[model samples]
Target: MHERLSFFVKRDSALHHLNPLTKIVLALSIILVSIFSPWYWTSHGLLLVVIVPLVFIGKVANEYFTSALRLILPAAGFIFFMQAFFQPIGQTVIFNFWFLDITQESLLFAFRIATRITVMISAFTLFLLTTHPSELMSDLTRRGLPPQFAYVIISTLQILPQMQAKAQTIIAAQRSRGLDTESTFFKRIGSVVPLVSPLVFGSLVEVEERAIAIEARGFTSKKAKTSLYEISDRSSDKFIRWGLVILVIISIVLKLWLS
Candidate 1:
């Protein structure tokens, strides 16, 4: 069997064995609490106290940190710099340059937003690193999620990597054919059309092929299909999910009360 394309790393750990829905709830709870909490440092606290430790508990610390440094930090850092300079939320200027000034309030606001984004991405990264996408879909499908909805979720998760791989292949082929992709800025911009045309067309053809293949496998059939692997949703999983729900409620209440 061909291995599935996903962020999942195979390992034995408490976090890995938790029900996929429980992990989903856990990630969402972290994100919601960080976003809705009244305290300015809530996101930073969650990142340090909860998400970081969970990375170790899941036994994927090295992989998680690699992904954070490679992908998550750059995205969050960009947002931080943009919001710090352009948010225009406060008047107490702390630093000034020709046309750009950093106010104390803006800095604080940007820090909160950046940290919230970091917590959000890190929690989801942890979830994906631990939970297999197929397993997640199977659990959701067994729990009464519509087959089409589950398939959409699975597709969304897997598409980006597929597209990225496809783009690289296309770029390599173009370079082999004497395409000028790296010489100058305008040449790079001009090369984008050639790269994009094939990528878009190829992706469309792939979608059609996948649709035909799934249809042949009875994707539209109403009969219950069996999963090759069983997903466990133990009592502990339910308890954890409920606890996350409670935490989310508390955060929302606190935000409202403080407001």
Candidate 2:
């Protein structure tokens, strides 16, 4: 269950070894192009031609697939379904149920939007799977990102797993104490107070503990701090980042001209 919340997968592969900034740029590039490109099939092509192959190349195919099935697909599916039913765009209605109707044009539009969302999510997933959060934060800090901002980003990435773990622990403890979480709907809703109270308080305690811990480590010191690990930015990483930038520029130009 904790692994489900943790996105980074340790693997020995070229994709995993790439500079974290390069991976960030790569993910952003895919997302920008997918959203901005005028071509209807751009997202589909990116998923098949780029994202899928990168998963295997990163040696994180299993983890990526699991994340996609559990999280990404459900989200995109919800968006697709909502847009298909609720979007009042187009006249050729193919299916109608009371106030909800699915038109041919609306269906196509929903598919395009959902596919673009999938592509964006998949790109970020791939990056997270290959690049550890610490490495990414450290690299960004070295590249002129303020440490305060870097700490915030890393904390955001890590806090979800911590909160999930805490929630599970609280739920288990409550279950052992005869809490009725498995009862009817209202009973379950009532049981949530017992579960959430501890989780929220525990999280607040943790935040206080972390603040003290960081302060003790001279987190606010003006002196330059050294990293335990030296992050590399090789020529290849630079080349890839530049190429991605050029592609993004081209995508913007194409969208402008075509639109």
lDDT of 2 by residue, 184-244 (tens): 9999999989999998887887888899999999999988788999988899999999999
If scored against the real structure, what TM-score would every candidate get? Answer: 0.87, 0.87
List model 1 lDDT by residue over 1-259, tens digit each.
1234688899999998999999999999999999899998789999999999999899999999999999999999999999999877789999887788899999999998999999999999999999988888899989999999988877776787778888999999999999999999999999999999999988888888899999998999999989899888899889999999999999999999999
Span of ten consecutive residues with least summed lDDT in model 2: 1-10
How far in Å is the alpha carbon of 146 misplaced in model 1? 1.8
Candidate number with greatest TM-score: 1
